[model samples]
Target chain A: MVVAEVSIVPIGEGPSVSKYVKKAIEVFKKYNLKVEPHAMGTVLEGDLEEILEAFKEAHREVLKDSKRVLSTLKIDERTDKENTIERKLRAIGIE
Target chain B: MVVAEVSIVPIGEGPSVSKYVKKAIEVFKKYNLKVEPHAMGTVLEGDLEEILEAFKEAHREVLKDSKRVLSTLKIDERTDKENTIERKLRAIGIE
Candidate 1:
């Protein structure tokens, strides 16, 4: 499983970006991936290709309204061990 | 408190990016931020200004060797609530 952390920032959009974020969340949900929306960004767990596809679609969705959009993505893929948001926190002794 | 999720990617760099990532992590550690390094990127918790300063320094550090670098940052600041990695996971019932 590939766990991706993504944050899409719409430049020039006022301080409030809940609308764009909501749309991005909708895209993530459409993928049927397990998503956890955090204060900073959203955590998604699924196949890498699916996650990348979702990212692209979400970027396009946001770009439709905003002139420029910055999407930050971090993908974690491990063949030896399964990784989830919960497991990552557990590895760091957060629990 | 502000929690920032940052991922620095050096474009054109070969598949191995551990060196650049290590430098970035060193910068994060120097700021005395509580950092949790995961598979994709590192999660940093500290004051907003301090986190931004660290990000700049880390970006510079990586740029010394790579020509093009992409840094993605997400900041989460909530005046009404104290947020932490643990709290975030707990909010989603991960724990």
Candidate 2:
């Protein structure tokens, strides 16, 4: 499994962007991937290709309403063991 | 031009991972991309392809020294106008 954190920003969209973020979240949900939203970005867990596909879908979804879209993706894939958001946090003693 | 914020973490490397981060930053610098290190990640400004290439290089550099690497990239690209880190923060009144 891979964990990806993604942030999509629509330029010139004024200050509020929660609506765009919500749209991206909906895309992730539709993909049936585990999603966790945080202050900076949203974390997703799924197969590597599925996560990338979801990221692209979310980016495209957000871009539809805005003139310019800027998106970021962070991927964490492990071959040694199963990795998840909760496990990552707990590893650092966050929970 | 584009602005990318990247964070690479080497899994199972305990709590301190600054050394790994430093390696990534060096790759960005070597690529001659403008880089700004932040609390959460590093912001880079350069051509989109260059930025992506540097990201890959950084990821590989860090991966060489660790077992598993997890990296995150956030890109802000604009075709309407030039985009930079300062302008982004200033747009939101951060000065």
Candidate 3:
């Protein structure tokens, strides 16, 4: 599995962007991926392809409202080990 | 409070970057911030200034071993409402 952290910013959108972010979160839900929404971005865990697909969909969704959108993504994939957001936190003694 | 999700990639580093990421995580801990380590990067919640300071320190720490480093940060700050990673998840119907 590959874990992706994605932040989509809709530029030119006024001060608050909760509405756009909420829509992106809905896209994640539609993909049936395990999502953990943080204040800045959302963490998604799933197969690499699925995660990428979801990101594309989310980008499209956000673009519907804003003329310009900036999406940043960081993907972590380990072939030797299986990792998840929860497992990573546990490994670092977070919980 | 502001939440920042940062991912620091040490360019030219071989396939595995766990060592560098581990060092960065230590920097976040040293700053006494609540950190959640994910597969791709780490989520830190703290005052804006403190978070930026930690990122600076982590960048320096990562640079000790890596000749080149790329750090990406997304900050979400809302003056009208208090927000947090956990709270965001809860608002999205995730616990």
Candidate 4:
């Protein structure tokens, strides 16, 4: 799963994040994306392609609002299972 | 009381907003500023001048973190008693 981090800056909302966040929740639900929220942002988890598409769609909405848009902190991540990159030698029958 | 809205962008933090926002809470406390969180942002309330000073202080910290800085949507507001701007015609002795 991929995690898409986002930061929205309202075009003219004057920093009323509560309104924008609530709308974001709706977008997530509409697109069936999984989100893990921490503070004023959300970590979206879904298929890579789908997640990116959703991100684009979300940003489009932000632009439409003309009251808000995504800011700098917005980012994306893909999960690769913890410690999977470091395999055990015994598991590989090596050493 | 005035409300100062703020947004942060971590310079090299790669968009890990959760971490930065948590730290921001500490900074807010350190400055003795009153914050009312509305989502991924905060609404600061205090004396008009004090509130603005606090905003400058907060932004300075963001820059110091070197991980993130303020973005658009940050705004400030000073409260005025409701209807005070438009005194009642009866009270003003004018129809």
Candidate 5:
């Protein structure tokens, strides 16, 4: 599983960006993806397969109107590394 | 410890916002705070004690120029909720 945080900036096409965002949400729904939509970007959660496909389609559609898009991506993999620490501590036989 | 994602928008006072951001960073540093600075806002990670103070100061500085400050905040507790499920499953005798 992976999370993709994507931001789409519009140049001469603010409305285009809005429309693209709405369309992207609809498409992600088709794939049963989790979406956290923001004013300027979206935070989506799903498996790599679903995320990659949906993101690609979303990117492509927005890029279709090149004169109106500036896309930025922020990716953060939310994982708890604490488990590794706990395992190591347990290996040392410490509670 | 808590992570606070704060967005500071400037009204007629964007430069004041920029200045406030810089000053705010300095103030946070004075108290040893972690900051993630973005174009539109900042993401600060610290204990509740540290974050609230810096944020309040930051908020005050920006609001000083009432004709030029708009502030927005977003908070997310980035904890792995999956762990609870994993532990429950383990107790139920599943991997």
Candidate 6:
């Protein structure tokens, strides 16, 4: 399994960007992945291919609304062990 | 200031990717940004423009050696307050 954290920033926009984030979250819901939204960004857990595809959609969804967007992603994939959002948090003692 | 977490994954490469990661880290060191290399990825603390530019360079650096690269970035930028890697960890009681 693969887990990724993504944050999309729309440049020149106002300080508040919850609306754009909401749009991306909406897109993520359409995919077969677990979504966790946090203060800094959103975490997605699923297969690597699916995760990357969902990320692409989410990026495009936000880009349609904002002219300039800077999206950040951090993907963690392990072939030896299963990795999930909850498992990662549990390891860090957050879950 | 902005703090971003970035991860670069080179596809089709063997499971071991430390070499590619090392190359990207070297590029990040050339900028005036604070670099914190963690288990999963690297955290960068600096201005938004500088961080983005540095990210672009780091991405290119990794891409040069790898045939296909998948990069992930999570940027946290605040206009009202200063944000650093240390402060972020301290907030979560990691420091």
**TM-scores of all candidate predictions against the true structure:** 0.59, 0.62, 0.76, 0.41, 0.40, 0.55
Choose 1 or 3, whichever is better by lDDT.
3
Expressed as tens digits, the lDDT of each residue in A1-95 for candidate 5 is 45566655556763223455665566666775667554334666667677777777776776776566666654434354322223322432334
Index of the highest-TM-score prediction: 3
Error of 4 at A93 (Å): 41
Candidate 2 stretches greater than 4 Å from native? A1-65, A82-95, B89-95
Recovered share of real interface contacts in candidate 3: 0.38
Give the DockQ (2 decimals) of all models: 0.17, 0.43, 0.41, 0.04, 0.04, 0.14
Residue B84, model 6, lDDT: 76
Worst 10 residues of 5 chain B by lDDT: B82-91
Local distance difference test values of all predictions, in order? 0.80, 0.82, 0.81, 0.51, 0.54, 0.76
Please tell me what DockQ candidate 4 reaches.
0.04
* Inter-residue clash pairs, candidate 2: A72-B74, A74-B72
Error of 6 at B12 (Å): 18
Worst 10 residues of 2 chain A by lDDT: A47-56
In the range A1-95, model 1's lDDT, one tens digit per residue, is 88888888898777566678878888888996888776567889888889999999999999999989999887877666666767765553444
| Interface quality of candidate 5 as DockQ | 0.04
RMSD of each: 6.2, 5.0, 3.1, 12.9, 15.4, 9.7
lDDT of 2 by residue, B5-92 (tens): 8889998778899999988888899986899999999989887667767877787688778778888877766667667877888999
What pairs collide in candidate 3? none
The model with the greatest lDDT is 2
Please provide, for model 5 over B1-95, each residue's C-alpha lDDT reduced to its tens digit, 9 standing for 90 to 100. Answer: 45455655556742223455566556566665566454334556556677777777776776775556555555433254322223322432335
Q: How many Å off is the CA of B65 in candidate 1? A: 0.9
Better structure of 2 and 5 per DockQ:
2
- Model 4 chain A TM-score equals 0.64
